[model samples]
Target: MCNQTTTAEKSSPTHIYFDSPEKHCRGTDYLCCSISDIISEAKSLFNLAFPIALTGLILYSRSIVSMLFLGYLGDIELAAGSLAIAFANITGYSVLSGLALGMDPLCSQAFGAQRHKLLSLTLHRYVVFLLFTSIFISFLWINMFNIMVYLQQDHNITRIGQRYLLFSLLDLFTNSFVHPIRIYLRAQGITRPVALASFFGTFLHLPISFVLVSHFNFGVSGVAASASISNFFVLISLVAYIWVSGIHEPTWEKPSFECLTGWKSLLKLAVPSCVLVCLEWWWYEIMIVMCGLLVNPKALVASMGILIQTTSLLYVFPSSLGFAVSTRVGNELGANRPYKARLSVAVAMFISAIMGLSALTFATALRDKWALMFTSDTQILRLTSVALPILGLCELGNCPQTVGCGVLRGSARPSTAANVNLGAFYLVGMPVAVGSVFYIGIGFSGLWLGLLSAQVCCAGLMLYVVESTDWEQQAKRARMLTCIDIRQPDDFDCNKGEVEQPLTCSA
Candidate 1:
């Protein structure tokens, strides 16, 4: 929740409009804030964003560890592991991650509305949903060999990938709990525990991977096992911390048959969220495939790989900011503080813009040296250097657009974002990429340019939607989502009839 203002101040409609600084409400509520308030809001957002970013960085390192060990196994193993990882990310991780996001608005808003039981129920429902989904993903992995072979993949590589995925099955179930639990905690403004647990798990991953791959000679399977064990560690560590710390005491509800039902509200948000995420995630995979078709594909593909790694590394901050703002916005709306929700959006956007600029500068200034981190091959180095600036340009748009997506999610309007992504990436970007690369002979860089185009369009559309948002309407929607029974205060107007089904969530 957020700092509470006096009832009279809460009743003031001026703040809701976000009017000029001169319009100050009585009792410490102001339509516009002084410099100090802006700084305070920025500080609050940063406090939330930094820990999430750190957790993301630590978790991402787990993959780097896997890749390093796979390389040690040999070229074929590395190639197979990379392919399997990509496939897992596309077909498995992306879906689960996106589906888990459906809980963000519900949990954050429910917590804000002081509907503690709702939070617990929503969490349980999502955990079950993801677990069920994982069963299907497992089947997909089981048939990965057939799928890869059908796609004309090398027999040896396909076989290795198949084995890797088979051993990786445990990850899906563990992550079923892991993903939602992290979000459940995050929505309550609890991040340090998740960060610490990830650190602990990732820390153990190194030795566990060593023992399994080197000491026991489990080979590729060991690498897969290490990943699953690490994830399990993360999941268990999170649950243990919650229990010992008693953080879950307030919101933890007993399991009930109710969790099995109520799929309607969750699925409404989840399916679009899944599509929105998969569209963007799969775009990178498609680009990687496209890279293979370019002239001198080996070098192009190699350069693309390094660039993708670079972008993923840089993506942590923006994505973290996005989540932070989502929580902030949702919490405020749920608490009936439209002013604070809008403030969250503004402050987050400013921060993301600055971050994007910094990233652009870093990528541009260090383009030559950045590639050196991954390769000594002269051709790849030159190719990566050329692409780095474009990648930087992509981030310039990527950061804001990503935050925009979060704002939409917080507002319970993920369908809008999904549509924006579909139109921007597929409608506009894909054609541009194909035209530039094949028709215009722009080569590998064209693919990035295509991505940049998507980012630009996405950012523009997202900003438009965000700026045009009616925060009060969103707050009303939040109340409905949490099934809050509102007793309109004497001085406050609850915007009656703005949202239907105000208590339908309970029904």
Candidate 2:
């Protein structure tokens, strides 16, 4: 039997071996992980997570700045701006961000396996896709006034909101490039530059917004323009950095006709990614829309907007953790190191829990003060205060579940994440929110309670999927995905370490 095993190993070209027992521990399954190994993994995850979190926080601050200016303009402007922004997110940014995310696994895995041309091609294709998507979104923005009026929104609010959306048109195009480029860079484990560029743009946003909205009194249009300008600045900064540093040269592939075609596989992943993101993002916007149905909608809508900003702020931690883990897991799987990928997920979940707890504490402790940063309206402030703790509670489930979503994406299982989100948000959470608020008459807090329910359910489901994952199978899938030119069944034998012959792409 021993002689047979040796002969089998010698015949398998793909068989992995380690130089020592310690190397074996690093390369094999997670069952052999020691306390020290866990600690080491934790540190690595954090190192990647911190800069991403910082970048999210900084980039998000641009909108907060926009909201602050709107708040200063008075409650009417604040509500209008909030509504417009929510619409834009549901119809525009969310779609772009989600579609761009489809590249996460492809880029990360391609980079891990040193398939540099594949990484570059994927990025090029996404840029083209997002640009085309922006055109449709632009048309949507142009019809914002008609849509809002058709929906029976207040004429005054709709008028201002329409202007806001119209002025935001430029941002749509800039983001097409920004979102894809960020993902491309992030796949290479390059984050600090992105963060630095975000900081610079956000810093410039303050003055530009002040000049346009405050000093010149351009109102909603000025605020929108400032945001667009800031986004453009970020895009320029990132491009210049790439050119100056030439860090992308190694992985950068010349644009080819191939990028224009062969989108079937990309769309398979991109569509699901877009769906999951839209499902989650649209829920928040749906909540804002629901607010309009409640009594005194102006105050409620404004309050909901403020609360959403607060959530976005808290989201930085989990978002970063999710991003880091996705990249880490993709890289590991692409390298055929299933154990390392599993470790990344485990470490990310632990860190997400800690961050969630911290967010909950922060929200509860400063429930009163947090809203002051956004608005001065007494009713809006009171309503925001009442819901802050609930939002905090939601984060408890939000953090871990978010990390879980990243894990699934890294493993190229976006469809599972999409299905989980559909059930959690629409099937479970939506009914509760509608029932509690409209049917049970629980008021504003009921909406948050529904979100909390969704988050909890999502977290549980995500963790179950994560725990049940077959890491070796995922490693096999990664190999096939990174091969780029191959279009064949992954007949790699995990037990025997035998790989199947690759076939050429059809057409």
Candidate 3:
């Protein structure tokens, strides 16, 4: 007989974290029910979040290192390199990273369900899909010079930007491979290896950029080349660790033709995931590009770059928590533990709120001083100070919204998050931003305020969606989706029976 277990059966937990509530609580007090429960959730979140945040910080420092090297070259080189990096992020890097996120739901759910072979196949498929996607993105980079020219950017800056992008093209292929490997490991809660690899890679980057640009006189191209080379180093190190460590041995399967079979489901999630990320990432890039068309374009563009970098630096905390919660929530749901999944979301939001407040205080307090790290120009510094407070305020909403989106992804609801982003950023934020910058004449400060508005809107929408979510249904969906072959009777039946052995909760 086919194995059968209903949602009602899975909803009843053998072990309860809270004393009073047998049923899942939608109230805020749910998280505060027991001190021990809160402590356990915090420990689990911190363990996962710390390494991811550190890895993000280490990786982000590579760009900062490159920018510092270029700054020594000249203001023009600094401005041009920044522009090229922003453009690359919008056109290439962000898209690739977002698309690769398709693996999050699949791999995390598969690992949670103990479907080891399914995890291996999904990883292989993403590798293949991302590599093909990189080729098209590479074509865009090759033609970026012309695209910049058509946009009527400065001739000298355009030339320098093109040179930087030419060398940076190598990262396209390297990252295509590296990102999936990183995500595959992350799905299994193995974040320290990637963090270690990023630390070593970034530690090498400073000297590499110094030698290539200053010692060899390769100019801006050297900065770009060093960044790409550092990524390759990280990739090599991660691959070596994965093989030698044997930690992921059970999930490692020989490459097979069956890996090609999941394009439809993967793309269904990937396209929306891409849209979800790109909508948010590309907004900042668009603001940077728009700044280039303003009066005092160079100074404004440079100031915007500093602001973007600073915000990105602070963003590591919330983004890390988002990734952590996604894994935690998805794992619980896959294991058919709806109560635990809801608890993870509550804990993640609480953590993000505290982090957001801390970020706001830091950004506001250092508004005057933060820009000094990047540039000394009085105008650029003044503009950045004006924007920093707004950027900090924006984080209050942005951080929680980020975690909220992660909850949606874990629940197999990327499309819902995508729709919220579309309406919030485009329908509401973009118009306000354009009017503020051009018609209202408030400049970069106005641009940030618009973003803050969008964040507020997104946060409200996501909170509602997550609050209203049917955890039992989400758990059912996760089980169905993670099955090796949901269409097959034996595999489908096997998955239903698999959930009978309740998943053990661990940090």
Candidate 4:
């Protein structure tokens, strides 16, 4: 295995390996080698993606379980719980997740470059940052009732939302710890334990929710508290696993003031990551809000809710592929294997494309029955059936675009993806959705049409950018970003005119 000359080695002269000249001279041998390289890349991506996908499904199911418990309480409680969760996701959860992603290239590249101490410091910095952010989010949750009342939301719903959010505040801090730790593990290609932690945490959620809400009569607050407990469970389990398994022996370091020195570089990546994600996430929320203004607003909202839930459920697979590719590409680039990074992107895109097609087919086949899982209302069923096929078509674009964004994040080019999202969703998608729904009188169907258009546009733009990327330059940037000293560099440069060699440091 050590003697094998792979495709990445053959393509890049900087790689310290060589193929036999005679082997290259034979066409069949070269073809066979290329096929083997492709297979290897595919297998590596699959191994990373599968566990991540399962983990995502299990984590998301925790929320689903909460909603299921709320459903049993009655429609009023269910609606309030849903609204509160959506508010939390938009205002706090999604932002935290996106900002945490700023550490993706940093951690993955540091691990790739074998700078284990740097990985530990990066994780420390983010945990502090997210914890600070969580304090502000907790303030928001504490004042949710006042905020809702000021907006003139329904009084009963606002009261329930406030109660649920109050109990959910603990999750904010837990997630601050969980997100960074999970990213640290993933960057080092240690995902199975993280997945296992999530599985057991989620498994505990259902029964805990039932006992709290059904047996103890704690109602919606109990459901929310159960979720917080589950999040804590996941965090504890992950931390214990890391300690007992001895995975942190090499990388774990005492936290210091050095973690606070490099705020600029971290923020540069994090701000755009937050914008890119929030723009997409807030667009869906905006759609739901707009649905509340249409004729028979209740039915439209209910139908849109079902559709959103369905789409969110399906999103796990492709999003997992994106995460896998981000780690793989960042790792390769950090190791200065640009060709391998490029190959990983290709394999990831191919896998996402297949997943997209499968999603499209399955959604179409089950269009009539998909909404039945959430509701029995004839109007909602009708609206959902009509919209499900469009949602499927949207996935064809969404899945690949999601993976492409991950590629950009790994390449340390989140600004490009952020710009594309602004153009696609705000400038293009929102206008089309408004015109189609109101002026064109297409109702809920128009909302989906507009969404489909945005997805296609975003996907096309991301594909072009990824295809035209300069992999060698990205590798250099990863080095400049991750392998340097924690203090911001004054003389170091990453530009087209001058590319520095990889920085070498003691681990």
lDDT of 2 by residue, 202-228 (tens): 999999999998889999999999999
Give the winner by TM-score: 1 or 4.
1
Which candidate number would show the highest lDDT if scored against the true structure?
Answer: 2
**Each candidate's TM vs. the true structure?**
0.89, 0.91, 0.91, 0.89
lDDT of 1 by residue, 77-162 (tens): 76567667767888998999999988888888888888888888888899999999999999999999888677665677669888
Q: How well is each residue in 67-175 modelled by candidate 3, as lDDT tens digits?
A: 6777778778888888898889998889889998877887788788887877788778888998999899988888887998888777788789999999999899998
Better of 2 and 4 by lDDT: 2
lDDT of all predictions: 0.83, 0.85, 0.82, 0.81
Model 2 bad stretches (over 4 Å) = 1-30, 484-507
Worst 10 residues of 2 by lDDT: 1-10
Better of 1 and 2 by lDDT: 2
TM-score of 4: 0.89
Residue 227 accuracy (lDDT) in model 2: 95
The sequence of per-residue lDDT tens digits that candidate 4 reaches over residues 328-351 is: 999988887776887788778888
Model 1: CA > 4 A from native? 1-30, 74-76, 152-156, 216-218, 294-299, 485-499, 502-504
Clashing pairs in 2: none
